[model samples]
Each structure stands twice: as C-alpha cells, then as structure tokens.
Target: MSTESIRPLIGISCGDLNGIGLELIIKTVSNNKLLELCTPIIFASNKAINFYRKSIPDSNFNFQQIKDFTRINPKQVNVFNCWEEEVAITPGQLTPEGGKYAILSLTAAVEALKAGQIQGLVTAPIHKKNTQGDSFPFTGHTPYLKEAFAAKEVVMMMVASNMRVALLTEHVPVQEIGPHITKAAIVSKLKLIEASLKQDFGIDRPKIAVLGLNPHAGDEGLIGAEEENIIKPAIKEYKQQNNAIVQGPFSADAFFARGYHERFDAVLAMYHDQGLIPFKSLSHGEGVNFTAGLSAIRTSPDHGTAFDIAGKNKGDESSFISAIFTCIDIIRQRTAYRENRANPMKKLTNRLLANAVDEKIEE
Candidate 1:
C-alpha cells in the first residue's frame, strides 16, 4: 500500500487515571494536525476523557467512541470504550479503581495488537504497584508484554534525540541488582541491543558502551569483581563473536560527565537507576520508552504518572507527544525494512528491465 494510504493505527492505553495519564493523552491529541500522520485509537472511556476535560477545560481534544476496530475514524481521535460501568474519577488520588481501569485499557489495547487490529502501541504510564494483580503479576509493561507475545526477550530501552540507554536489570531493588549482573545476562542484553539497533533503528552496525555494576567500575577489583569477572568478559566474548562493536565496563559517573555517551549508538547500564537517572536528566521531559525486540512496536513516555499534579492541568505532554511520533516513525521504518528484505533483487531487476527496453528500442 502507498505510504499515505497506510496510516498505521496506534493503540494508546490510558494509564493510571489518578495520575497524569488521561491529561497527557488529551493534550497530545488536542492538536488536529497529528491525525494526518497516523490514526490514534485510545483504549479509554468517554467518562475518563470527560473527567480530564474538566481539569483542562481549554483543550480542543475530542474522541470518537468506537465499539471495535471497524468503527475507527482515521481523521479523528478514536476511543475504544473498555468498560461502561461508571468508575469513580478522582484525579491525583491513587485508588484500586485507578489501577483496575488502567489494566482494563492496557489489556484491551494488547488484545487489539495481537489480533492485528492495530499496527503499533503507545501506552501511557501505569503505577507499577497498584496495577499489579492476579492477572498482571509482573512489575511493569516489559515483562507483561514479554509473556503476552511469548517473546524470547524484550529490552527496556530509553530513547532521546541525543542519547539511547538500555537497562540490564529492570525494576529490581538496589540490593538485588548485583546478582542479576552475571556474564550470561550481560551477553544476552548486549546481543539483544545490537539486533534491536539494526532492525528497529536502521543502524547497520551498533556500538554499545557497557557500564559496570560497582563503584568506579570496580576500580580494577578494588570495589567489586563484577567488572573483571562478569561484565568485561561478556563484552569481550560478544565482541569476539563479531556481532557488533561492544565496549565498556566504564564507571557510570564519568561516562556521562565527559560526554562519552555520544561516542556510541547505545549505552547498557547494569540497573534501572544507573541508566534512567542520566537519561531523564538529558531528555528534559521528551524521552520515549521503547520496548525493543517484541514482534510489534511499543513505546511509552519515559516519565511515570505524576499523581501530585494530576488534576491541576499542569502535566507536560512533550514526552507523550514524542512517544506517539516515535511509534509512527518506527512502524514506517519496519515497513521499509520488510520491503527491502522481501525483495533484495528489486534494484537489479529494474536495471535488467531497463536494459531490455533499450535493446528492444534499438532492434
């Protein structure tokens, strides 16, 4: 299909209503100009939108209610009503109902993704603790999606215009972070990061910088042995295999300070805070959280649901807006990648056809 004709359907999950989820969603789609890029189907309800509308009364964002994918309006913001029962809408207050509805919207959007009803997914933030229940036992979206799609691996990578960072361990306590920093784990993530860069981001070859698990990168075993015994070896092995350019075991502090981050396509940190702390600082509220290595594309705003300013209409929507654009851009890139892979000889075929036509004209 023509690029213009194939405007990807992006499924947006309403995160914790108590936080800034709904507010950001409304702010993102408030401008009608965004519809020209792709069709957005929000997995939320009219009531939730109305609640946020009251908070931000000046927003021009509007939603077209749809029962299913068939009812989507390409030119308008579409809301798939996940539930009809009136749930209490208390902005800025965390409640069981908030988590419950967040799951509802997320689950609905995931189903749509699996069924091929949507081309990609851009989820809003969901409070990790309250969103966890019998159905969603995992800590966050990465693990849940890994199980949902039966994906072998999914790397939680944060993307800003200037920097890209991936975490080796996600949502784990600081004390428990060391155990997960083994050679095998680091190697696994390195390979995943390399492949994701090539396939998702269109980088032919990716150079990754790896951070150490201890202070001063173990200070050559003075602080910890992880750098010498685990992280360094993994980087060496992966590099020897000729997969991609992998280097590091750098001290996390100095790496970002000296602008070493710009040397590589991506940086692999040992834990969440190790990576996210610098990423958020550099991103300036415009970072996008991309779950790489999934069969489908999924991106979310890097920031979490800000409960303190939920109902105040004070939430910044730049990250959310960037997330939406990122999804669309990735979908387009994937389409082009597939087309190129599917027909490797297209260029040669065109050349041969042109030569034959010239010969026929001469004859």
Candidate 2:
C-alpha cells in the first residue's frame, strides 16, 4: 500500500473563529510535508477557511471541502464543514458566534473520533468564557474531553522536547487550590501520570518529580504542613505500594531555576501556573498541551487565543504544528505498546523455540 493509504486520519477542531486557530491550521498544513505524515481533516466550514485564506499573504494553502468522511483525501488537507448556515467571521473579536461555532466544530470532531472515523485530534485554542453555555459547561478541553470520552480521570500534560509537566489541579482558584491539594489527589494524579508515561510515551519506567504547593515546598512545616503532612505522605505511600521511582515535594522555585527538571522523565506540579509558567518559559513556543490517560488521543497548542495578533498573520504556528506531530507520535507509540504487550507468553515461547533450534545446530 502507498504511504498515504497507511497514514492516520488526524482531526482538527477550528478553535474560536475570531482567533488565530484557522490561520495556524492553514499555515501548518500548507507545508505539504505534514501531509506525508498524516491526513488532516479540519472540522470547520469552507466559508471560514476562505475568509482566513484572504488574510494570509501568499500562503499557497489549499484544501478539499467535504460534507462527510466518505470522501477523505489521504494526500491532501480536507475540510469537513460542521455547519451549512452563514456565520459572521470577526477576527480578533470575542463574539457569541465564535463560541457557538467552536462548540459545533469540537463536538463534530469528537464524534468522528468516537466513531473511529479519525485516529487522533489536534484542537486549536478556544475562548473559555464565550464557549460556556448550557450545552457545554466545562473550563477547558481537558475536562470537556474527560466527559466526552467517559474517561475516569485525565491528566493535563504539557509536552516538549526538553521536559514534560503534568498538573495536580487545573483551572482552580488560589484559595480553592489549597483545599484541593490532598494526599488522595496527589496519589491519584501520580497513578495517571505513571500509566500515561508508559502507555502513551512508551517509557518503561518513568522518574517523576513532584513540586510543592508553598513558596519553599512548605520549608519542612515552617511555610506549610502540606509537605510534611499531605505531600510527603502521598509520595511515600506511592513509592512503597507501587515500588515506583517517584520523588519530591520539591521547592517549585528552585526546582526549575536550578535545572533540576532535566534529571527526571516528567514533573507533576501542584497547580496550573506552578507548572505552566516554567514550562512555557522553557519550551519557547514548542510546547504541546497533551491530554494524557484518555483512551482517545487529544492535543492542543499550549497558547490561548491571541486576539491582538488574530488575522494579522503574526500568530506563530510552531506550537500548533507541534501539537499535530505530537498527536501522531502518541498514536504510533500506543499502537507499538499494545503490540508489544499482547500475548507475552506466545512471544516468549517463540523466542525459546528459536534459541533451542540454534543450540541444536551448534551441537
């Protein structure tokens, strides 16, 4: 079979139409080399694509518009229209129309994923406030996808070439964050992180570093008791029970400042900003926000909707491009992991038989 026929179908959700989501999609797929890796099916309308096409100069970006998945072009970028009615396109402005259509695109792409029409999903950034309504009432993609895929729990992991970071509590207020950080929560997130590191990233044994909640990781109970009472106990229990290579309750400030994150496979932060602040700073626009521990793979650009640079063609496509490649990579890893883990006894028997034949020949 041709390479195109074997390539996986990756679904793309047009984030907020008013933002730089479509622009990033167009620029990323325009390279054509990306098409060599996987077929892209963008979940947006032809009209919206055309609108953004006019703003970007000399993009040479082209796509095949299809009403359904029956006619997906494996070698070209495909546009799957989620809506037929004409919708207003207001670049750089947060409008109700933007949120409504973003939901339409996201829900459609997710359904395609569920139906096995697509193997993976790469979502553009969406505005949280505008997208909230009775139909969809979640903070961000991680929570929303957790509900969509019926996953018991999911980790919001930020991945890059240098380091990988996962959050303990995401989208929570500072005052509320303290209450959420408990022994149970810490142990639960560690479990998800451990499983994801193996299943998704193909790490046989992952060394994870846990960051502290207080300024100096509770300073041995001077700053806070979470480290001595809550954080330390959780880490201890996890290590003793699972015999896993996990460490810390490390001071967040010194951990990244001293280049300590490089020593481990991944880092688990206490909250959103604690992990993301350093990650974005260190990743330098190459970070991809990956939703780990889910049956279906989903990734997004680490940045949010940039209203100031929207439609100006100044929005960097690097993170969005990285998200697509990360999605593809995870799909391959998961496939390989499953194959390696399937029927271990059969593999061992085959190995033994080969070894016995070799011994007989030597004799």
Residue 6 miss distance in model 1 (angstroms): 3.5
- In candidate 1, the residue pairs with backbone N, CA or C atoms under 3 Å apart (3 or more residues apart, or in different chains) clash, namely none
Distance from true location, Cα of 334 in model 1, Å: 1.6
Q: Model 2: how far is 340 from its true place, Å?
A: 0.4
Model 1 Cα RMSD, 1 decimal = 6.7
Give a tens-digit lDDT track for model 2, residues 335-355: 657766895555454344334
Q: How accurate is candidate 1 locally (lDDT)?
A: 0.87
The regions of model 2 sitting more than 4 angstroms off are: 343-363
Ten contiguous residues with the weakest lDDT in model 2: 353-362
Q: What is the C-alpha RMSD of each candidate to the true structure, in Å?
A: 6.7, 6.5
* Deviation in Å, model 2, residue 342 alpha carbon: 0.5
How far does residue 239 in candidate 1 sit from its true spot (Å)?
Answer: 0.9
| Each model's lDDT | 0.87, 0.90
In model 1, how many backbone clashes occur?
A: 0
